[model samples]
Target: MTGLVIVGHGTRSAAGVEQFAALVERVRRRGDLGDVEGGFIELSRPPLTDAVGALVARGHRALVALPLVLTGAGHGKGDIPAAMAREQQRHPGLSYRYGRPLGPHPLLHDALEQRIDAALTGASTAGADAGTGLSGADAGTKLSGADRAGTWVALIGRGSTDPDANAEVAKVARLLWEGRGYAGVEPGFISLAQPSVPAVLERLRRLGARRIVVAPYFLFAGVLPDRIVAQSAEFAAAHPDLDVRVAEVIGDCDALADLVRERYAEALGGDIRMNCDTCAYRVLMPGFADKVGRPQRPHDHPDDPVDHHHHHGHDHHHDHDHGSVAVVGGGPGPDDLITVRGRALLDAADVVVVDRLAPQGLLAGLRPDVLVVDAAKVPRGPSMAQETINAALVSHAKAGRRVVRLKGGDPYVFGRGHEEVQACTAAGVPVTVVPGVSSALAAPALAGVPVTHRGVAHDVTVVSGHLPPGHPDSLVDWAALARARGTVVLLMAVDTIAKIASVLIEHGRAPQTPVLAVQDAGLPEQRSVSARLDEIGASAAREGIRPPAVFVVGPVVALPTTGPTV
Candidate 1:
């Protein structure tokens, strides 16, 4: 049976050291692995070599090394691996498989939510009533249902010099905010990064949050966690009108132990999928180009037995390639609807060129330093020329910066995505496209109008309505579409719907054919206007339905409602 070694970046705090040991014990108690040991790479007791030796003494030669970290920072990506390599030199015939860092995992998110809930519960019990002269958790009570919704969260992370690692914290903040009902969740760092604990709390206050909870996104009690608590308390003391509470760090819990075991299993099974797209040692980030292809070295530990005098004369060279561009679909309106590949590209991007109808909420979660070019082409209003937009993408890619052109719905569904691709190809820039959920189908479906129904409608046709029925540049066959006994979905046709409707009716189409116009589909402001084919234009105009809308025409639109009205 293979043993497991839980590697941690050792801390000065005895409590943290104890907690790490406790977690190892918890994992050992599961009895799934042969032997389990926990050790630190630096600062604390039981160095990595000692842990390896202990497992070897227990007759376990093969081992799995798992990093007890929340993100892929310098420690996980460099220090721990280098230290493990040194162990091989010390012990002959010893082998180990390395695991990825512990998080951005669902289990960690669940743990964070539990901690936040506990803090809120504890705050209520402690009479954390604003302006009541009672501060902290001195007086015990529970918060009402209303108070829960009014509460905002400030998640604090141990900041890193690596921008990728720092961005992970912001991603965690966004993940915590999703679905979990709170006023909002903001990311802050204890050090190295922007938006310090105090600054985040102040921003929350400025945003009109009356009750705020500071949730430390740490695995155990450490100096950084303690600093987070102190900063939160200081912020609370300064603002008597606000109810503030600090959640405990994720300590030695079964959930965390299970997560460690999962990582161990993954390492043993060779299922590790470490995120290298944004790794500073691989990607060419703005100020971190020097880090790319840099060799890893173990950090000096105070408790290490070795004196550690080594010389570096190795000449390592790597060819840096120019960056590429991705034309990604942002789905309809909600950021969650974006494809996984598209989201990943966005996360790795140095610059994002966004369209008017793209999911704008995603921009909020991007790294603070990412450049966002607004290429919004508002119909009959202000617009950015396509030539200028194409130039921006090529220029950014040529400058060795990852660029993403974020468009709404599917990039190919009348999104002019191919035009951008051609332009990039002509400019000798590498370009790829990520498909998205098109609003043409999503809008009608979201509005409870199916584009096609069995027997009722056997076919569905999607058309662009940018021009009226008889325009010189229009290519849509209105008469042919009218004769078809199927669904006809119209995109970019809100303004020309009146003339288009007349032409359809003048042909073989019935005036009473059911029609549904859905605006801002898949979004909070989404709403629909329904009427007969003949009256759809007037109905939509009367309802003030605007662009970024989808119009569905067919007997399928008359089907019984199967979803929410919006």
Candidate 2:
């Protein structure tokens, strides 16, 4: 009898395990396969050992290992294959094959349709319908075959670093966006990647899409998906002009069972005879002779052999358990201004990995031999890519060097340090971050402008100036920012000064409201400009002053300057 093994990336949540188990059982009840079993590679499990052991004990000779992953990366590409290889070795008599992940499945489209129907129906009950009177029939349209010709769908997934995984999501997105008859399809990620859900939604809305459905391509309902739902609500609320709906996550369905069965069949060799002597099954038969009825293979299996050179064509001698590197933020160009903890790390750094903004004065007192690298960069021009910087930090730290990934300001605040931290952690290189003063607050103070001074401003908001164009956080509630009864400071926005000012002015920030641009602040090249919010762009353009520039806007900025003593 053929055995089907469904594997999941085990989670700590018991509820998640129960869901997986229930899914497996439901598929089993359909009587599609001879035997159905579930296994986990990590966390909760009837681990692979037990799952395969049970199947082998049941006299199953052919087995299929179906990875319940949304994409083929990390676990799907490497770990699952490794586990299956181990299982194959242990049960040499069993012929097992692994299958592709259940991504871009049409059933996922069905789940999306159901979710949209539920949302719209709930909306109608709440009296939010616009009289399009889109019933279930209108709401639940699939982007398949001819119906997809002009159709476009935005398929959003939780982003992964594995290129293959992202490629799979992108492939599915292309099918929905370009293949279908709809207007277009877009692939985006909730985190760890770009074309964030909000950006994708906005783009689709602007595409003159009379009807736009925001399909979430997630396998489970977790924090990220919940966040996407909440964001969808906010997005729809913001754009009452657009018809938007958030779809449900991919759930248990008969299609998933079919996918598992397909995997099983593939493992058993779809075109080749299952009982042929040249089969992989010969390894299990051992002394049965007939040369195991297969080709005389080399003694070394390349997949299992250890190679000193890694797949990346780089020399890697680091152990798997290297401690994380230390990425400390030095704040915006100050030595003593750095947090005491950040300073300590700076002093102790074996390799003072500085960005363009790390004050040289701070590094002056450091050990001369300490390695210092310039990773600081800007966008749209010559600068280091985030991916490159992250790799360098992880690689150096893995080599047992104390790395200080010193950023210009607060590491967590738009510094891209989170990306670095994730890369390091994924590579088994530990990381610790120390906070520093962000220019958002400091620049205003240095210019005799208080973000909040009683009766001058009540609310203070600090926003990044150079958020990537397609960033999820780039969409500001400009009206909210404009209505700030207090001070507003924008950091690193030299390039966006014109646009930021325009948005504010349009949203009720008075054209006459005083705004100050502090350039190269806290250093010798420091310069300051005071202009009305409307004229700030003109002033910046005239001065030809670029970043690292901060914009301070508020009535407090109109306060009389106390000279350079400020």
Candidate 3:
């Protein structure tokens, strides 16, 4: 029976020595060879010369020495071979052969794949923590492949001095990315790489990646791998949004035995026989002797298997002319008070049809490429008619482009959003409406006034003061509203403020009822004036306030302010 000897270049770092020990333990567990042992070449106890001398004393001949270096250059190429030559000469009667280093092998790719699988699939136990839970199906629920797309694996290792050594590790990571269908694969070093593991994880978070797994691309358990794992754990803990897992270190499996055997075949002889019985002896290797052995997968391809013959074709469809129009309600005057979605639409708009009500400062967020068309621009005196504005909205949509109709407050409340939607629909174009924080309510609230209070008022009525024509009818029946002890809010009533206040006072309503006029509701220029129903008209005139203001009146207006304190 032939004996196998695995040799590693001993390092001063304790982590490096532990990695070598783990590899030797793995090789010893494989029950295929007669004797399996490992020795360190330098910088460590149990040096190669002494170990070979001991093996020769045991009468083991035809010993195959394998180098566990990650690269074929440097120590594996020169120093280890030179040491073997000196050992063979010291033991003149012992016959020996030296094998190649473990680099650029499909087996290394396999090891990486296994690490990824373990990190992604999670631990075997029901509630094991380290696992990322990447199984395609779990508990009778199948997960879509796209759902796992953002799952990333970053291979972190101790940087190599040799450029070729670094390239080899990077190449293995690339192969694993393609083979496993990962969303992204990145090669990082604890020292050398531009994007360290932490930097890469930060970038992944910005990219909206939900889960990341760090696979240490080191052979045996080592110091650097431990540090990298610890760093990965700390990074994961900092970000609760991302799930992170540290995978098992490479070269801790017997499949690596096949890698060592293949490299040996490339060195001294050729490939080994498939059957273990044909070999000289069946021996136990380290890490491979689980009493029951980790249960074999029922179906190795638990999910989709690679189909070499399966081909797909790209299908081209007709160019969609679904012209989109963005209707934004620029709430009162404040830009930040607008919904986030509304702002996004306005920023990307092709054409922004702003009215006289929208604040000019809020329009600064529009993209430079956007075409601003002021539909309500009173060029000489007054703006375009309502029918003309509606026609313009229909024309923009029919041209197959984005149109943003910026309005003030809730578009439906007084901005006429339904009218624009109907016009777009009639033109066979698409329309999306983004509701904003209506100034009708925000205005009163920001002015230290609550339209509804526990006992003061249980109901509120909102109406436009201007009638469509001269039929002399307001939306709210003033006679009926005067009888109810509720609040009343008015929009675009500045021109008729004196008349409305007189109407309420004449309808058997108290002239001393609290009234609040909130101007520029949410903007920096916001101002609020509190007075009685009769004094509101005089107070507003004194303040020189104009239209686009909200008027609120009722007993609820007397409630204590809920706004910020001085």
TM-score of each: 0.53, 0.45, 0.43
User: What RMSD value applies to candidate 2?
Assistant: 23.2
Q: After superposition, how far is residue 129 of candidate 2 from its true place, in Å?
A: 20
Residue-by-residue lDDT tens digits, candidate 2, 1-566: 66888887664445556768878997889886778888776545567667878888888877788888877645665567677776677778777766777666666555544444444334331112211221222543333444334334667887753344566788777655442355676888876456778888888777776455666786544556666767767877787766666655555656656666665666666532122232222332221111122222111112223332222111234221122366677777756677766766565566776778766688788776678887757556678778888878877776656677888878887778788888887775646766778878777777667778777778888877776333477776777888776788887777778888888887888899998898877776778888999999899989887878888888988877684333
Query: What are the lDDT scores of the predictions, listed in order?
Result: 0.83, 0.66, 0.65
- Span of 10 residues, lowest total lDDT, candidate 2: 125-134
Winner on TM-score (1 vs 3): 1
lDDT of 1 by residue, 1-566 (tens): 78899999877678988888888888888898768898888767778878988998888878899999999988899888898888887878888999999889989999888777777766321212221221454423565556568889999998775788899999999999898888799999886567889999999999999878888899888778888877787878888888888887888888898898789889989999988888988886764543566577775565567765421111211011236788999998888999877887787778999999999999998998889999999998999999999999988887657789999999999999999999998876668888999998889878887777888999999999999999999888899999999999999998999998999999989999999888899888888888998999899999999988999999988888866444
Q: Candidate 3's residue-wise lDDT over 1-566, tens digit each?
A: 67777887554456556656665665667656557777765554456666666667778867888887766534554557666776666667666776766766778777676666666655432112243332222321333465347578787755542344556667777887884667887787774324567887788778777777788777755546666777787788788667777777664456666787666655457442222321111322221111111221111111112232321111211111224576778776666677666765665466788887775676786656667887774424677777787788877655544678888777888777898888776655557677876777888887778778887889998867765223356456776766778998887777777778888888877999888888777666777777899888888999988766889989888877666211
* TM-score, cand. 2: 0.45
RMSD of each: 16.3, 23.2, 26.1
- Summing lDDT over every window of 10 consecutive residues in candidate 1, give the lowest-scoring window: 311-320
Clash count in backbone of candidate 3: 9
Top-lDDT structure, candidate number: 1
Q: Candidate 1 deviates by what RMSD?
A: 16.3
Runs of candidate 1 exceeding 4 Å displacement: 123-134, 137-145, 309-566
Mark the regions of model 3 whose C-alpha exceeds 4 Å error after superposition: 1-321, 377-380, 467-473, 562-566
